[model samples]
Target: MTSPRRTFAIISHPDAGKTTLTEKLLVAGGAIHLAGEVKARGANRRARSDWMKIEQQRGISVTSSVMTFERAFDDLGVITFNLLDTPGHEDFSEDTYRTLTAVDSAVMVIDAARGIEAQTRKLFEVCRLRSVPIITFVNKVDREGRPVFELLDEIADMLALDVAPMSWPIGMGGEFEGVLDLETGGVSRPEGDSRNFQGKVDTDVTLPERFAEEVELAQAGYAEFDAEAYRNGDLTPVYFGSALKDFGVAELIDALARHAPAPRPQPAEPAPIAPEADEVTGFVFKVQANMDPNHRDRIAFMRLCSGTFKRGMKLTPTGHGKPIAVHSPILFFAQNREVADEAFPGDIIGIPNHGTLRVGDTLSERADIRFTGLPNFAPEILRRVALKDPTKTKQLRKALDDMAEEGVTQVFYPEIGSNWIVGVVGQLQLEVLISRLEAEYKVAAGLEPAPFDTARWVTGDAGDLKAFADLNRGAMAKDRDGNPVFLAKSAWEIGYVADRYPKVRFNATRER
Candidate 1:
């Protein structure tokens, strides 16, 4: 038998305190003693388990960080948590989409004052599309002035979530008192001693006279929502806290262990390939590149979607060359990396693999299984680049190749004189590419402004193509459904010149 595990993601819009909440959770769950803040140390902060340096400096998470923490609940001695802290920015939204494939549920963090923003809606849609359970956390109640009740109402209306409070703030803003535990009816306020209030919650704190009626009405509303959800089939439960001040955090942890979906022996590992009858399968979600004085290693972070992975086992990765050692999963705890010998179903395992295993590649004991590759993403932006010194031109190519291998961003080499373009979704990504090339490969690259190209493809009737040739003007084309096609740059957009159109003809200037 295996200890129960919960696989969930922490997601939010920018500056909503998702990472801060993550650090606090790690410490409270006994995973780490010292929590590092991204702002305090710039890059000196040991890159957290999932976040990279580029993310910390920009104060934005591009890649979802994978971390595990353990806590005992009720009679269960050890509950393992495999958490994916997803990026809040729209540019790295693909990272969040890929995470949905592995996680069983999501903890949506909404800024209390801002209520629900654009990215929050997008993230919620992703969770809804996948039918993953959702647990909403309303954060940031410590900022000078905030309306607690109004924020809660706004969240419910914006997210259309049946808001249920597992814990509620005892006060508001700077004078914020404590949290009222919904289940245990306890209050734990913020103070120097707040961190010490772990599993033991105080049930006998008297509510201030001003909030007495408000608390009662709020509690009643929460009970009604929970009761209705229970009557139906939805299991999602909402909770609240000030992540910055550590208010209502312990209760949130308790709710995570108690209410969030737990890993079970899935009947079959999910695969997108044919026959649909196959053994369990899993995929590597992240890879950590570590170079130390003694050893240089590449750790593949995997999700066990189907079967179990044991220590010292050898397995072939899908769509890649040879077999690699399964040296064991690892936990980055107390500034030390230790090997975890066995990984059960739904567990996020970090195995030592030197082979080429991309983020979305799948792994399975049975050769017959395969899943649809990771979700598709549009590379909408491009930049022109040149080597700072012509002497390092060759080295720049090699540096770009290495960056591709590490999954930094998509790189394409066009015609010789063509703008040495690199495709990314945003500007910050371009900067990281340059920094990585200079730091790791000793190649300095310079960036030049490039015009944005609209991706277009031809898929309509050839008869209408005649109109296109008469004008000789090109505009971004959309499909019948209006979705821009992927990899459209390489696709042919045929514009027929006359009323009589040939089924297919290419202009001489068009690249074959």
Candidate 2:
């Protein structure tokens, strides 16, 4: 029998050493010989899992990147690891949700110095809502003066997580040295340092007096977690480490293998749909187009929701003159592409040599049940761009279409001949697009900050005035102008703004 697979997503606030953690995990699992670093300029600079050009330049992940790792578990024997690395920014939260929906659990990384911030809380809530088990890691303990205990308390309070430390920090802040594994009672520190350890605990150590006390306290806390505690509904476990120094990484890997839940049994394939259903039958989650002298090609990343896709599969895709044959089954790995001979239920595989798949469009392998809805995209932040040369307008349109297909961007054409309006998740996202355009297509796009609406609810005359001004680009909206406009239609947007601008009290009657 085949070994079971475990799927989990890694999430965190921006710059919290998430990619660093991922690299360590991949290395520990023997997926790569030596770990790669995120350099400002280099051949392999960005997150190894983060393969997008836009993502590398921005230094922020805009989409979830999936990769598999395998390692032996002390208790579970051999395990297949299916890990998804998610975006840290708020605008890409929708992408994060989709990634989570496909996985069984998550590892939430937090900065030791910064503790839990707004995005951390938001993502945690989403996990809670999905009832996904989560493990929390407090990273960057190598930095001096980091308050490990205090950060642990903050994580539990801010995120309301039932967290217990799996290891104790040997020292914190500037004097930080290593970690004491609570389970094995082993001590692992920087390799070169001459720190003698008799067993799991150190003897005659020079650790901070307060830290020594905290170690004992941390062990006690772990002891307190009984089967009943887990059964009664606790969702998070806290671990400490410095990904930069690689200290405690082994223990973290061990904890993941031990505590993280395995993916549930794969469900039986869905029944075949009829030969004709107009409800938008298949989903195009990814797209890549290549044009060379010999061949003009487009690869559509698809997930067959309710049908089977085999060799010679056929479907009448929208905007196509006739049903195109499934020319070849393909798989996308960042810039590299390959062909998969067959694909089936719940598998995300790519297809090449076809013209019909659009981001968010559904496809049908059989003709019966259809998947109509596109995964939700957050409200776009509007910006103005002028082509460096008028002649490059057509080239720019094709480039933008590819970007949209990749799901990292949104392009809007307000009018037929208007200067193109590109909706982006954040400023960094725009910078990345421009950089890619100039370098790859020899086109430099000039961007000008444009006024955009992030609606806030207000009711009292003062509140109404403020709300109206925000809608008209007058007051608070102007103050926070560059931010992406909050979708006025979403209750989440309404409640978020209402709490943010409490002074602009809502008149229940008017709101209704």
Candidate 3:
């Protein structure tokens, strides 16, 4: 039998301590001895998940990271954890959205001081739409924060997620002692200073001696936590901790093993897939370019939904229907990777991409089912990319194609022009693209403001879409996937086109 598996992503608003929580969880799982801070100064000491040079310089995650580790728990034995650490910044939310399609559940980190932020709400709605089970972590309790009750209420009110306390904070700020395990009813305090707390949690210790008054006050106002509701996804079990101090992290891991569901069935186009199916099946949710600077390699990250993946197995990609060798399957720990012999359901594996695979493409041994729900949101910002050196035009085009294939940004070709128009979620993305062009591809590029501020996909009958595209050739383009799109200068332009073309539908996102 397969070991219990929990594949989840960690999500939060920017500066909510999501990266710190990711490091602590890896530390708790014994993947690494010491958890490095995201902003560590030393050349060799940085957060494992933030491996990219740009990420290290900016001190923010710009790309999604895949990490897999195994831990032995007292109740659940050895379980494999495939943790997808996603970017919290809204500018890179398109990356986060794609990563969410590859995970079974998510761990949403909420800053106790600032409850229910914009990015948090956006990511939560994505999870809710997929019915992904969520476990909340109330982070940065080592500092003064809002009342726990109020924070919980805010999550319930803003995100519509019910709250269940798995572990309650003893106190906040300077008086911060530790967390009380509600199931065991024991207070576990940090043994040392805020910088390092290495002692084992003494669950046998009673709360009265250390936090008698605080616990009493907390219990007086706290309502009963329903464990059943938590498991049902109706209520998210909340764990409070200072991730920087490593307090209550172990408890969070334990709760995840005990409560989080394991390798649930996934919805596919033709049918839903069970975890224990006989044949192997999976879908590519992410494609990354230039992971290795020397080779300029591309990797397709696939989430195995059913059966087993074997080395050198030939499986048919859903759309192509041609057998492709599953060559050199790899698993990731930050930037480091190892050849994988076999992988089970709920496992993420990377296959070498030679321009053959794409995001939302499915692969299987005996089925032609496609997985749904991977989306391409309309780009809010548009720009035209220009190469500094005209001699490197081929290199520039290749780099743009690679990045566009990775879903880093959307690339569109005008109906009548040879120039490429870039569509991005924010100005920062365009900057990042230009930076990557210089750093990774050794080509300097610049962006000029385009006439369009918004882009929408043209969806309707083939004839109608063609007529619209032909009529507005200058303002019309095709995306990387060859989908027709209309670039509009303003809301009035979008309305004008919509009113004129009654048969055509303008969509903010492309349906899978």
Candidate 4:
């Protein structure tokens, strides 16, 4: 029998100590030797999970990366954990939403001082929409922060989640003695100048009398930690500690191993797919290209939904409707990878391909089954590409097409001319586009202001669409998939055109 898999994603706002917590979790699981090894140590060392020249230089994760590691539970034996770390920037909401679909649960990391942030609430809503249960980690407790009860109340009021405190901090900042282990009724604190946290409750060391009273009140304040309520998405168990200080890292891992759900059924067309179903089914949530500059490789990250998958098995992707043998299915530890001989449900496997597999595509043993719910929203920011050297026009187009396939940006060709327009969801994407063009494609390019402010995928009766397009041919374009799109100069223009053609649908979102 296969080891139970716990696939989850870590969602938080940028600079919420999420990256530190991720490295610490990997260290606690014995996936990597030192936390410093997984994270960049000095100025030159790159964090193992973070790549991309722009990401390294800017110190932000712009793309979703996967790291798989296993931990042995005394009762459950060895549990394989697939950790999907998402970009916390609001600019990457599209990517974040898609990543959430692939995970059974999520860890909501909150800054201790900054209780709830805009991006954090947005991502939490995404999880709530899918009823994806969450585990809350109130990070940075070692430093001074908002009162513990206040943070809990804010979580309860803002996100409307029943917040349960699994672990409590003693005193904060200079008065910071240590963290009280609620499970053991003991305290664990940093030792010596090195500040090495033992991550174990010292039975001999008792908590201060006043701190003990506070702990008693904290326990009685919120709803008790109920496993069923958590799994059902009604409540979230909270843990407080500083991720950078390596505090509560072991406890967080233990919480995940003990409470996180195994492979859950996936939402699909016709019917939901059960994990125990005998057919191999998975969906491509992300398609990344040029991870290896040397080979210019393209790998599709697939979240296996059901059945056992073995290398060299033929699976039909809905994108092409043709069965292809997956000869080199790879498992990831951040950027590092190894060819996987076999995988089970909830395991994320990478299938290296040229371009047949795409984001939102479903792969299955049969050609008929198609997974649902992964959709691309229309881009909010649109710009035109001006090349420094027009000689690399063909290469630029290929590069843009590749990036569009990765869902980083959307490229549309004007039906009337060869001029291309690129659309992105955020301003940061514009920076990424220019940076990637220069660094990855060796194409010096600059983005110029385009006339269009927004785009919509048009659908309806062919005659109605044809008439509308003919009337507004100047604003008409087609996406990379040849799907007709209506580019509007402003939100007002969309309403005007939308009123003109009631029969035609100008969709803000389109499912691939």
Candidate 5:
């Protein structure tokens, strides 16, 4: 029998209740006893997924977290869920993008009052590009918000997705009663707090007499669910509830178990690999440094695409081409992890990194196939990093190299032999890097504005690339991986280079 698996990521704009929704899902899944708030006061518990110190202090997820657990539905039996909670802040969008590549589907959380925001729109576009199926959660329904139809229309207009309501809110704001399940036409009301409501009647056979109007609205919304459109990725199944109250979480989980797609074959260079392929195949989508402070270790997050992964399994990392033992394969519940003896397709496992692994690298028992679709975009912001104490230069260099390998920031070596240039997608990434350098690496670092405003990786014949580099020595540089890069002072300079070096193709992102 096939393994029941559902691998998906949670995405949204900042403060759209993504983290809260994640906690509620975990609670409903029986992964944890109590759901923790993102910004709990005093000694109160914080979110499990936001385990990084920077995240806890700021109450924002700066990195993507992988969580694995199981939940059982009435009809679906036990289903394994690999949940990837991604950063909602725009500064960490690159991290989110990489995380998206590893998941089979995505759950997009939108604030009921705010509808779709900028970050949500950007992430939705990425999902559309990959044709990843999306399930919508209209959160914070206990608070006053726009009409459900307006929110649906906005999603359709802005994100170009057909909205299919799977569950409807009974009432809004202070009068918030519960949610109506469209499939069963049953009413699910919160018994009290979510913790107390656990295992209580999620679906009632008879509707309460006081919710007569809500029943009619739910019936109307229930009639709008189009299975055909939903299956095509053209439509999204929408669920409404207060994640804080955990009213509609169980229904959402049920829908996911019944409807979400299972592990699917992903495209590789030579061919697509089936999830049931005998060979063990996976791709490293993220590398995190200092998840454990004591060891100062790094972790490579690999999403197993095929076959079974045993602890200490011997596999070839495509980048190195040498056989290496997969040591202490781990499964994560936020920062907390346990030794994983075996893992299957659609499950993400963390491998200890000692400088050998890099993001986008693939590993397999066979050496022929290389996974594709993971690409690095050109940095929009450029800065020159300087070490405050020259004595700690070695430590600083090692830390910077580790961060670059993790794809947190791009380090560049200028041909002029000046200070190392730091390239980042946004200013906030640079800030996080500096903050980490001081807090984690104990290195005092400063950033100075660099002359370049844009960068591109040049691809063409070796001779042509050489000629371009020689002609533009001032603008020429090499990234951390020794890839050739051309920095431009402005758009005009990029245009001028394109006109001058017509033989070489300049790409905004490096082709994987």
Candidate 6:
């Protein structure tokens, strides 16, 4: 029998302590030794998940990271946990969306002080769209935050999610004594200055007399925890704690193993693929380049949907109906990885590939099964790449192509110029592009202001599109995939051009 798998993502707005929580969860699972603060210098301070230099410098997760670890639960036996840490910045929403498609559920991290934020709401909507159940973790309870009722009401009102507080804080900020587990009635408090987990949860259903009425009232106000409702994405079982303090993370993991659904059937063409399906089926939700800067390797993050995937198996990618051997299937704990001899449903395995595998490419024993819903959003920002050395133009082209395939940026070749244009959704992406260009590719390139501010896919009759393209040849360009796109100078220009060419459709997003 397959080991039980719980695949989920951690999402939040910027500075919600999602990264800290991720580290603590890893420590609890025995994946790592310690959960150190970001301020601590040297190797000891570095987070395993935040491996990129740019990430370390900027203190942000610009790309989604895939991490896997395992732990034993008394009720569920030993279970495999796959955690995808998504970027909190709204700019990386595209990457987050793709990562969500590959998970069974998500852990929505909201700051107790700020409550539901803009990026958090956006990510929640993405989760809701796919019916992805969420386990809410209200972090920073050790610090001063909004009242419990206010936060819970905001969750109920803003997200429309039924709030089920699994655990409640005894008090907040300096007065914060500990958290009382509602289900187990176990209480654990901070022991010393370290704030590490006490590891001793008194399973007595006793509550402090002072806070008894408050707990009672809050429990009465919110709906009871219904496993069915949560699995259906109608409700969220909330846990409150300070991830920085290593509080409530263990309970959060327990909640995941106990309540979170196992590898569910994945949406695919023809029919949804069940976990027990005979054929080995999976889809590439992300392709990252230069994960190992030394070897310049490219890895495709594939989420197994069905069957037992063994090493040295040849799976055909839907992108190119050709069989590719996956020799080095990797099970990841952030950047630390090991060769996965075999993987089951809901397991995310890293398949090192060349340019053949891409985001949204489905790999299976056969070519017929193609998983869907990975999207490619049109770039919100475009810039012309000016290489420091013109002699290295070919190398820059190769690097840009590699990055494009990885979804880090989109490279567009215009019908007009030799200088290729790179596009991204936000300003940070431009910084990442330049950083990677120097660090990984050994080709230093600078991004100059592009004439076009926005780009859109042009779709319509061949004659009509050609007529439009012919009229505005300067704005015409082809994506790496050879798809025609019209680069508009600005939003107003897009509107003006659309008015003139009514038959042509300008798509902001394209199906991968």
Tens-digit lDDT string for candidate 5 (133-211):
8999888887777776667777877767766666656543124323433344444444442321112123533345545
TM-score of model 4 (CA atoms): 0.93
- Prediction 6 TM-score vs. true: 0.92
Count of residue pairs whose backbone atoms collide, per candidate: 4, 16, 0, 0, 0, 0
Instruction: Between candidates 3 and 4, name the one with more favorable TM-score.
Output: 4
Q: Comparing 3 and 5 by lDDT, which wins?
A: 5
**Per-model TM values vs. the true structure:** 0.76, 0.67, 0.91, 0.93, 0.91, 0.92
Worst 10 residues of 2 by lDDT: 474-483
| Candidate 1 Cα misplacement greater than 4 A, ranges | 1-3, 38-51, 172-203, 222-236, 264-280, 288-297, 333-336, 390-407, 415-418, 451-512
Give the lDDT of residue 194 in candidate 3: 23
Error (Å) of candidate 6 at residue 393 is: 1.0
The Cα error of candidate 2 at residue 202, in Å, is: 11
- Greater TM-score among 1 and 4 belongs to 4
| Residue 309 accuracy (lDDT) in model 5 | 90
Expressed as tens digits, the lDDT of each residue in 1-512 for candidate 4 is: 53489999998998897777888888778888766534456853665667788988887788999999989988889889999998888888888889998999999999887789888888889889778999999897776678777788888887687888887665532233344343454443444322212223234445657665666676777788889999999899888778877777777888888888888989898899999999999999999999998999999999999999999999999857679999999999877899999999999999999988999899999978888888888999999988899899999998999989887899999887667999999899889989999988999998888889999999998898899899988999999889999999999999998998999999999887
Better of 2 and 6 by lDDT: 6
**Clash pairs of candidate 4?**
none
Per-residue lDDT tens digits of candidate 2, residues 10-117?
A: 999898988888888888887765666733346666667666566676677776765556798666787767667788886666557656655656888888767778
RMSD of each: 7.3, 9.2, 4.1, 3.5, 4.2, 3.9
lDDT of 3 by residue, 427-451 (tens): 7788779878998999987888788
Worst 10 residues of 3 by lDDT: 193-202
Worst 10 residues of 4 by lDDT: 192-201
Better of 2 and 3 by TM-score: 3
The model with the greatest TM-score is: 4
**Clashes by residue pair, model 3:** none
Per the 3 Å backbone cut-off, how many clashing residue pairs does candidate 3 have? 0
